[model samples]
Target: MGSEPGAGWEFARAAAVHSEVWVITRPRFEPLIAHALAAEPVLAPWIHPVYVDLPDWCLRLKKHHRDVYWYYPLWQRLAGQRALDLHREAPFDVAHHVTFASDWMPCGLTALPPTVPLVWGPVGGASYVPVPLLRWLGLRGAAAELARRTVTGACRRAIADRTARRAQLVVGLNDDVRRRFAGTAAVVVEPNAVVDPAARGSSGSSAPSRVRTAVFVGRLVSWKGTRLAVKALSHPAAANWKLEFIGAGPDQRWLEAEAARRGISDRVTCRGQLPREAVLAALDAADAMLFPSLHDSAPWVVAEACAAGLPVICVDLGGPPIFVRGTADGVSRVVDVGPGLPARLAVALRDSESVQRPTPSDRWSSARMPALLEAWYGQAAQFRAGRDAAGNGSSVSSEVGGLVPQTP
Candidate 1:
């Protein structure tokens, strides 16, 4: 029901724990995904692989780098509705979107039925938390800043007004989203929950090597600003800074050329496209993570690095910054030196003191992540059920019980 992207696999694997996951995807991934799901005990048995019927060469159309991601989900949801309609012709308990209230879920992307409750986690850039600091740091131009403020304000105001006039159930992930549409919808801010701490405990330590190496794992595009990190190494402060980029994208060749142009051919290493396991292994020996993403929704990589006990140097975006507190314990610092990226990086390079000895939090471990997600889903169900019973249009009781406070 979702695009055959890596994150879709993440959601399907997680949701498969509570519900049978019947995934509709391209024939290309049928065998590969079936194998992966079969290995995971919680995800295997209920995994149903449904073939995508297309109007001849739809896969070919998708092979073009110019393809838009929204197209496939839109087309597939339309097809899924026909199938779900047939299935419900008999009887069923419920059908869920399993994400947020998106126009792109298996049901909503096509007008299947508002009858089936759909949930969407707005992990996309649309719901991105705007950061004024990024603008100050020279991340966005004045035009971009004005556009963001104007567009976001206008759209949010319109949505807020519409939500107020309607009697509907909605849950906001944070106070910002809740307050944005406050008067319009009775939004509930079920703040993020931490899952596992005890299991996270102390991780295996990575010995410091003479070389100060950092790893950046994500798509290699112009906006990611990964080149800025490499260029920063040229600054005397970080004369010995080494980098490894492990992701595939359109701008791979361009980046290699850029590195050469900057005469940092040796400092930066580009390993375009490695398996996820290999990428995690790559993160193991690295000292820090450099993530300068231009567009991010919930940048779990920030939290993931924290859990791995790795310090990170990244542009201060609102969502990822939530988990990052500028200290040795979590994030080193969140700076608004986007255009000053080179200057700041040079400063970090020169100042050996910039690399602080971290006091890692057990909360940021992978062990807690599962528990966190589980607890969130539990609240999601309860919130929905409570609102469902509140005469069609109601807010979750402010006094309503919440998900597990802390997972052991």
Candidate 2:
């Protein structure tokens, strides 16, 4: 399960239990959803899925890595029209734009009838990547990152502001996103809830191992900080620790070369990109998870690590801190990115046995997210109804209260 689609799939299933949800997504994903829904007879009845097909050129653009923004916005435009038609026929109380979970993306809900309260996000704004770390990426990589930030940040703020003003309630994936759009609307910060049954069942609640075998799982991207993890492993204190690298990307060769240069090639295992089950199995056998991601709003890997009862050694910044409970709480350790980071990581690895197996709280579990969303939908509906009443002297209390029809 990659990030957004996996999350959207989980959210729809979770939301369906308490409400009748009409999902608007790309036509490309309908088959996958249909297969899953058909397999689960109980959930099939509640969700009404509507696929918005983009033009062929836009769809082809989506196949490329960098052109998602081009296709996503165009698809949303079409979805807006489709939503308008649906609204005229059935008059929904709350309209939610769930996927493309970026605060920067203009949501279809913002264009919907104001009487239909908009719930935009569970969205994430760009997370900051330290420039000092980017120096490791060389001149070309550093320049590309700088350029991406400059362009994307400007566009994100402009569009985000537009969505904020119209949304009755905006759900942010982290405090950064909440702060970015706070005053414009009711902002609530919540991390994405991961619902990996395999991870949960496999935890078995075993104690942390004394022989430390740390694992880093994620794409071998520049910001993933695989280099940082490698640097920490090279320290004399971490000579005894073994690390398994999962996932593949451009950085694999660099990591391999770095590991060889550090003379710890034998200790490091680059497993490449494995299946989700394989990754979880690897995590199950490991003592700690090393995820020093430079920038991320809310990463699913951190959630998976926590769910598997694996203590994670991640940076103090971004979504990692929210997932890792830290050594003080006997779950994991959060380290600051600076001169002593490598030493700190070595120490954490050395003391892995002291850290207890962490059980992800209900707050981070999928079971709780739907209930939270249900409450938020209800609140947004009430806010919209109140505004409408004040403006037009018309009452819509009945429809407002049942924004999500109860599953009898």
| Candidate number achieving the greatest lDDT relative to the actual structure | 2
TM-score of each: 0.64, 0.90
- Alpha carbon lDDT of residue 199, candidate 1? 23
Local error of candidate 1 at residue 32 (angstroms): 3.9
User: What lDDT would candidate 1 get against the real structure?
Assistant: 0.50
lDDT of 2 by residue, 244-293 (tens): 99999888898899999989998888999898778888888787888887
| Candidate 2: segments with Cα more than 4 A from true spot | 61-63, 196-211, 326-329, 359-363, 396-408
In candidate 1, residue 126 scores what lDDT?
34
For model 2, give the 10-residue run with minimal summed lDDT.
Answer: 399-408
Q: Relative to the true structure, how large is the alpha-carbon lDDT of every model?
A: 0.50, 0.73
Worst 10 residues of 1 by lDDT: 399-408
